[model samples]
Target: MRGFSLLDSSGLPVAKTCFDPANIPEALHLDVWRQASRCGAQVDSLQRDWRFRGRTSNWYTDGVVFSHTLCDATHYQRTPRHIRRGDSDCLVLKLQLAGHQQGIFGDFDHFSSPPGTLVLQDWAIPYNITTTPYEVMAVSIPRYLLRGSHLMYRRNPVITWQPDSPQARLLVPILTQTLKSLATASAGEADAYAAGITGLLDGLLLGDRELLQSKYRERDRLEDMRQYLSRHLSDPDLGADHLCRQFHCSRATVYRLFQREGGIATFILRQRLQRCMQEISRMGVVQKGFLEALAHTWGFSSRANLARHFKAYYGITPQQAVEAARSHQNEGQREMNAPYWRDAYRVSRWLESIAPGASPTEPAGAHGGARQGPRELAGH
Candidate 1:
């Protein structure tokens, strides 16, 4: 919606950069930079969608942020020199949408960067290049975000990720397609576009980390609340309906999200008895008083009810469960005694949020079906 001005390739928009190519001039117009200079003498004229280019002769670092764009069937050359020092310690993370590029990072090595190829090389460093007629897109990003790429990779560059990695394939498309549709800003719009560039860069390096972070946060929040409930199950008010009221969610929504294994009441009862067994076993001796006390505390009205459910869930009577727990040092049988039965509820709730009423082609994994609790839990 907002326009951000960025310099782009003169002819068909090809080349290199650190700034926003999306905010540059339209590929057909070519007004971002008035002229192309091989080393300030303007050796190579901006070929009208054809010819070759070079690296930057004199690179400025600390003060100015450097960036450029190159399009298909074009090349801009710069004079080569041994890069000594400058504020720009970063390298170019170039994406090859079409054609093959030959880059000389330190020694001459042919870099066949093909379409969807992502390569990294230093700018404040030094390099030379001989080109063929092909379309290429690149960005001169800040060095800090590239991990060890700043100091370790100038002379000997490496392919951190292949086009085949799930992350690379997912992100490269977004970058290349947007650059190919480059456009200049409407004046005074640079600030907005700069912000967008930050977002785009984050998407590239982070690989949906931000998105996954939120999902973990959601799981943590729910886990914190669930753990707290283990202590107060005896309070009949511990069911999902009550939790919904406390958490300010509707009854149906709470049931759908938090009780997939069984309804809220069932999960609460199970966790309560399991906790009771744990407390009973910790005394190091199986006793009826200890068992009954914990069972009632967790809201089991009578010892009989607790024993019935405990036996059904864990295949053990209260007396036997306590003995087993004590032997394990108060550790309850989590494999079958915990609230696992409730997971289907949470997963179903997760799916509903992303694609309500739609059948998921991919089911959750062995634990709960999805790798992360629920499929929709990704963007949490």
Candidate 2:
């Protein structure tokens, strides 16, 4: 990190450093590591080519943000075990300017991010990063600063921008200019400036709502599928393949839709258990062990299986739910009714009617249905 600091007289707030394997001495490499260690990052490898050259400029904005630019020929960097454990509170948004880089973080496999890519790297996890000849502008801001942003919940590393995409053509230049302006501003104004930068970043991460919704039709389809499943919870054969056929989507699409919910089968099981609870609350002890019959109607294979899933999901047994319902009735209170199954069933039938005799792997709504485009797939 090398940049002139506005704060502190000892060049403590800003540092600008350069490295050239061709001419710079070995001691400079040691000095680079020392500077990196102070900031909780490490440079694990340098390109062997004598042509390798790099520059790092770091600016400390007190506690607002730590900004740095790393321009280099090629390198491999890593957050060592001890460093990750000790400095696990910040997040880095690295914008690629030149060549491509690839890395693995958390559950994601190696992701190859090209230029114009904005990657959010978590300091809490160790990552193995390899970059080709590239120049990157990185902003280190506390995880707390972005805690509530949509990017925080995306659970992915990269936000790619195609060369001709609106974000790439328009937003990229805006961001670049903003960063440049921030570089010259006084330290006292860092917080205000940082906030603006973050706001712009949020906008870049989550574009206009209607447009975003139109682009990510998969999300819409998933929501529709959830509603459809809720209605057909009573169908014993209602499962992933059933959902695929009903939604006119493939097995992969169905799996991807419910990936976060533990897959389509798990989602269906949970919905069935939830519906059973509704019925239990509505019917109460009047239909003793009627809970088991309801379970059968809702696709659970047996009473024991229903109890297992019920207890796991609700932290209570079906019998316990019945007791709670009875107690509520005694107190002259009522559990809110779930959506009418008849309506859901009708909607399910309608959707099937529209798609009619569709193959399991065919995309739903593709025949005459509108779908999201490339823009919807652009964010974190």
Candidate 3:
């Protein structure tokens, strides 16, 4: 597939990329589709015996990713591996146009999304979903874009608006029409449509009072617990029982509050590992017994214990993490000097001619063709 870019009215580039399995050999269809969709989650055919056929068109503009997909029944999962890699940080809003889907999303129990339902998912959380042969249009907005919005602060990461609900009734048609129009829209028209859709979404999410006062109170309590945990992370006894006593809640209440994070124990362990990584990065050198001291400071029993958990959580040993951090710092320094060398090289020939001194050779261009700046879609 070739990528192409279009300049919108403001001269900003809008990129689009597409994938279709029709022209490819049937045997490679699923593999190709999996590769195309790997950016968001792991996908697999759900049928016992099936031949897959699917198409996806994605447009990227202003840090938002808009996509339309039509595919066979498939299973999609965002596992802890995907979360640790930190690639799927967007909040996805999917409009289910046809077929049905059932999934476990964040703290929500198993739920079904019927036709015309708008499903919102925070990609930071893990999910497991399986869909019947379906057609859907989705928009992925960066989390930073909604950082301070009320929607992000909600306790639940997954939400849905049923087809008959007022919110869905108001949004469904506009979203469907906009996506259809984008398929054949000019650059300027697409930009205008995208902007309007974004504005509508912002208004809907921020102005909706679907969350009751009781929900807000629960969210506040949950946040308070989280702050307390952060403050006392080094306390070796920090667990459900400790949290329960400190927050004056029952064990069940504490556990339920952190259920989405895989229970309080998992949450606390992850926090300690993360804090250990931060501390390691700040220390310029790993001194003798540093790992052992750091392990004790972060509530780990010993260096070996810390290494085992760190490797399991982050896919790297603590020492390797320190080495990687130092390597990254060196790479950053090199990057800081790169522009100066590039500028000097650009004028090397003139300097040599004027002063008869040795001059740096210019680097060859990496490619010889029209530069590919943005992604491409099927039509435009």
Candidate 4:
């Protein structure tokens, strides 16, 4: 195969590199093969008596790495050390064009992929696999680019869809055609193809019921907690324990739900500060006593304490924010009528619609109904 290089739209080099065992003497083939696959996994053809013949072509772009390979039976293993090396944090999707493969991924989660099948592997986990002489087209996508959560892969890192499976039927032909076309594609075209493939994979994966349900539960719980916090922002006892009691969940659950927001306490403080800012902006040219009252209502000890945190978070004092709001009243009014503010208004209206004492267990519309346990809230 011929090799070429071109600059992508972003000015990064897009290159296609090829490796053929036939180009080199037989004695050096194993060493070269080992080196080439090292970044992904440890591979050995010794079980086939090291009489290996293979050729691979790889296309590298900004979004993904695509490779086509024809190789003899080989063993591949990724262990803790390989994961720790952090050479690749990609989710690999391999479409089997010929032959069969099987693997034990992430603590004996076994899966098989036959010709015309598509297999997924999360490189963050350890795996062991052996394959018969096979021809495959594989794409490696950075984990961050994909939708949904990585937590879904922790227990079951390897997944396979048979030739007749819906996912395989939809993806296999498109992937084959795209990989074949990459050889002649311009840099701009290559990037577009890569992005298209990544988007398809994201849609496919997000369709998994397990992933969708898990995400829904988490999102619902977080939204519920946020609504509760918004209503109770003026309450001095609103904290993790209070959330646990109100939601009928453990303290750890509350903490984990807000972990991304820098813990429950921080989220509450930030919300309170935001409320204070909104109040000050609305009041305009407030007195010292009013500032103190606003601070106290939002759980701050004094105006001075609120000012310290407000400046730290927003990079300006409360007084300055008030002045700025006054000067830009018309602009602020226009912004308040924008789509984003409209959405926020709708959300606030929805929050107000919920009863103040309603818990997650109650039917969303009314104050009283069947009570659900934390497990139900988690969607398990």
lDDT of 3 by residue, 270-305 (tens): 777766765765574778888899999988878899
User: Can you tell me which runs of candidate 2 are displaced by over 4 Å?
Assistant: 1-27, 30-41, 49-54, 62-88, 149-154, 163-171, 189-191, 203-380
**Model 2: lDDT of residue 20:** 36
lDDT digits (tens) for residues 1-380 of candidate 1: 22233333122221112213343223311222212221211111112322223221111111112233343222222223312212233345566655555433332222446566776554443443323334455444434333333223432343434699765675466545444333442212323333344355544544434322445555454555565666566685667656676678677766665553356665566566445533543455654577667667778778788888866654457676444334333222233221221222222232222211111111111112111112222221
How far is each candidate from the true structure, as Cα RMSD in Å?
28.0, 23.0, 15.7, 24.1
Error of 3 at 379 (Å): 16
In candidate 2, position 85 carries an lDDT of 39
Best by TM-score: 3
Per-residue lDDT of model 4, residues 19-131, tens digit only: 56565445444444455576666665513234335666766654467888777665576778776655565678999888777665654345667788889887777776666
lDDT of 2 by residue, 1-380 (tens): 11223343333222122333444343233333333343343332223221233544444343333343443322233345534333324456677777767654432323456787766665555454545567777665444344223333223333445657665565466556646765555544544455656556556545644324543566557667877877777787887888878878789888887886667776777567545754664564656568668778988888888989877655457776566445433322222131222222222222112111111122222233221111211111
Query: Residue 359 deviation, candidate 4, in Å?
Result: 31
Q: Candidate 4 — which residues are off by over 4 angstroms?
A: 1-13, 46-54, 149-151, 214-380
Candidate 1's C-alpha lDDT?
Answer: 0.40
lDDT of 4 at 129: 67
lDDT of each: 0.40, 0.49, 0.61, 0.63
User: Candidate 1: worst 10 consecutive residues by lDDT?
Assistant: 355-364
Give the TM-score of each candidate: 0.33, 0.44, 0.54, 0.52
